[model samples]
Target: MVLVSYILAPTLAFCNSYGTGLTDWNLSSTYGKIGLFIIASLVGSDGGVMAGLAACGVMMSIVSTAADLMQDFKIGYLTLSSAKSMFVSQLMGTAMGCVIAPLTFWLFWTAFEVGSPDSPYKAPYAVIYREMAILGIEGFLELPKHCLALYCGFFVGALLVNLLRDVTPKKISQFIPIPMVMAVPFYIGAYFTIDMFVGTVILFIWERINRKDAEDYAGAIASGLICGDGIWTIPSAILLIFRINPPICMYFGPSASS
Candidate 1:
C-alpha cells in the first residue's frame, strides 16, 4: 500500500493537470465503449480479443458497484444522511477520471487468467483477447449474455428504489439517501438466493417501511467502496486521515475534493 500510494500521488496529479476526472469515463458511459469496440475491431482479431476480455472485466466491475451501492442504500435508510453530501461524495472521485478503455481492457483481461486456476468456467480474459485478435469483433460481440444480465438487474433495482422513495413518508425517507443501493441486492438476491422470492418481497416491504430515513444512503454506500468507480477510493484514502465529524481545512488537503 505504501509503495502504491507513493507512485499514485504523482500519477494522479498528472491526470488532474490533464483534466481527467474518474467519472469522466465511468464504465456505464457508452461513448468510450462504442468507439473502443469499433477501434479494437479495426485492430483486427488480436485487438478485438483484448477488447472483449476487458469488456468482461468491466462488466464485473460495474456489477460490483451496483451491488455495493444497493447495500449502502439500505444502510442509508436506517441512517438518514444528507442527500447533497452524498451526491458530493460521489462526484468527488468522478472529477478525476480519464479514459484508457483499450489499455484497461488489456490489463484486466490479462489479470483474469493470471489469478484463476483451470476450471470448466474458463472464459479467461487473455484467451478471449487472443481470440478476438484472430477471429474479429463479431465473435467478441457473441461472447455471452451473463455480464449484461448483471448490469440489467442492477439498473432495474435502481428503478425500484426510485419508485419506493417517491411514495414513502417524508420523515422515514430521510434515512435512505439513495434507495437504489438496497434495491440492487433485492434484484440480485432474486437469482442467487434460495428464498429469493420471499427475500425480495421482504426487502421491498421493508424498504418502504424505512424509506423516510434513507438520505443519500445509497450514495454513501456507493462512495464507501468505489463511490465513483475508484474515482473516490484513491482520494478518499488520501483524506481519510481526517476522521472528524466536521471538515477541517488543510491547504493541501486531498486535491480540495476536486
Candidate 2:
C-alpha cells in the first residue's frame, strides 16, 4: 500500500493542488477514498481495513500538503515574500503539525466524546471514511437499496454541472453552484451552511454600506474570525483537561408532544 501510494502520490497531489488553487477546497478525503477502495480490494478481507486506512492516510497527507503549500505560495506571491523562506516555513510547519496534531487529537479524545452522535465534535468524515473502507472490502452487496443508484445519479449530475459551468457564459457560470461546495453539507451537516450564509449576508451588508472598506478589510476580518475560533479551542481543551465544565448546558429539540 505504501509503495503504491508513493508511486501515485505525486500525480494525485498535483491534481489536488490544481483543484485547490481554483476552488480553495482541498479534496484530499476524496482522493483518500480512492486509495482506500483500491488498497482494500487488493489486500482482501483479513488485513484490508488496516491497509486501506494506511493508504488513505498517506494519500490524504500528500494531497493536502501539496494543496496547502500551493495556497501558501500564492499568499507569499501576493505579499511579495521570499519563496525559499515560505518553502522552509511550510516544511517546518508540516513537521510540527505531524507531531502536534496527534497530541491535540489525543487531548480532545480523552477530554470529550469526540465521535459520538451527541458530541459537539462528531468527526463525521472519520465515520464516512471507515464506512468507505468497509464497503470496499465487503463489496456493493451490503449497500442499502437504491444507494448505488443514488451515487451514480449524483456522479452523473456533478459531471453535467461541471460541463455546463465550463461551456456556459461567464454571467451564467458565476451563478451556478459549485458541486464541491454543495456536497459539503451532505457529510458535515447544514450548520456550517448556515454559518456561511450568515457570513455572506454580513459581508454583503458591509459592502453595501462601505464598499471600499469592505474590499480592503474583508480578508483580514474573515481571517481573524477563523483564527479566533481556532484559538478558542486551546482554552477549551485546557478547561476540559481540568474537568471544568460549562455551568450552562443548552439543548434544543422538537417538543415531546410533537
Candidate 3:
C-alpha cells in the first residue's frame, strides 16, 4: 500500500492543489481524506485496519500539505507577495507545528487526561473521528440510534436552505443563518462554541462602529489577534514544560477541599 501510495501521491497532490487554487474552496482536503479512506479500506483486505489507517494518515498529510501550499500561493497572488517567500514561510511553520503540536498535546495530556470524565477538554472531534471510523469499518449497525434523526435532519436542513435561497431577497439571504454555523455547535462543545460566538459578536460590533475603516484594517487586526494567540502558546508551553505556575489559573474542576 505504501508503495502504491508513493507511486500515486504526486498526482493526487497535484489534483487536490490545482482544484484548491482555482476555486479557492477547501474541498480538496476533505475529498483527499475520503479518497484515502477508501484506498485504506481496500488495503485493509491484505494488511488489516492499522495498515488502512496508516495509509489514510499518510495521504491526508500529503493532500493537506499540498493544499496548504496552494492556498498560500493564492493568497500571495492576491496580496502581490512573492510565492517563494510564502512557500518558505509555510514550510517553516509546518515544521515547527509538527514538532510543537505533539509536545503541547503531551503537556495537556499530562496535566489532564483529555476526554476522561474529570477532564474539561472532552475532545469532541476525536470522538467524531472514532465514531466515523467505526461506522465505516463495522457497518451502520454500529452507529447510535440518534444517527437516524441526524440523517433526517440533514435532508430537512438541505430543503430548508434551498427554500430560503429561493424565497428570501438576496440582501436578506446574506444575513440568514448559515447551515455550517448552526451545525458546528452540534459537533463541538460549548467552550469552543462560546469563543466562536464571542468572536462573531466582536466582529459585528467592530463593523458597526468602524464602518469607514473596517474594510481596510479589520483583516489586519484579526490577523494580529490570531498571530498573538498562536505566539502566546509558545510561552504557555514553556511554562508548562518548566513547571512554572502562572499568577492565575482557572480551576474549573472540583475544589481542593472537596
**What lDDT score belongs to each candidate, Candidate 1 first?**
0.46, 0.83, 0.65
lDDT of 3 by residue, 1-258 (tens): 676666667777786787555433344445444544555456543443454455556666777788889878866865789988998999898899899988998999899879976679987755664444444454345557888689789969867985897799998897776554454456444443554465568788888998768766655565455435443557779999999987887667657755
User: For model 2, how does the per-residue alpha-carbon lDDT over 1-258 read when each residue is reduced to its tens digit?
Assistant: 799987898898997887766545678888888889889888879988888888999999999999999889867865779999999999999999999999998999999999999999998988888878888888666778998899999999999998999999999999998787787667556654665676679899999999999987776676555435443557778998999988999888879944
lDDT (0-100) at residue 147 of candidate 3? 86
In model 3, where do residues sit more than 4 Å from their true spots? 1-51, 70-79, 82-135, 155-168, 227-258
The per-residue C-alpha lDDT of model 1 at residue 121 equals 39
Taking every candidate in turn, the Cα RMSD to the unseen true structure, in Å, is: 18.7, 7.8, 10.3
**lDDT, model 1:** 0.46
lDDT tens readout by residue for model 1, 190-253: 3222333444464466568786544325334433433333534455576777753435664655
Whichever of 1 and 3 has more lDDT, that candidate is 3
TM-score of 2: 0.65
lDDT of 1 at 220: 49
| Worst ten in a row by lDDT for model 3 | 22-31
TM-score of each: 0.30, 0.65, 0.49
Q: After superposition, how far is residue 20 of candidate 3 from its true place, in Å?
A: 11
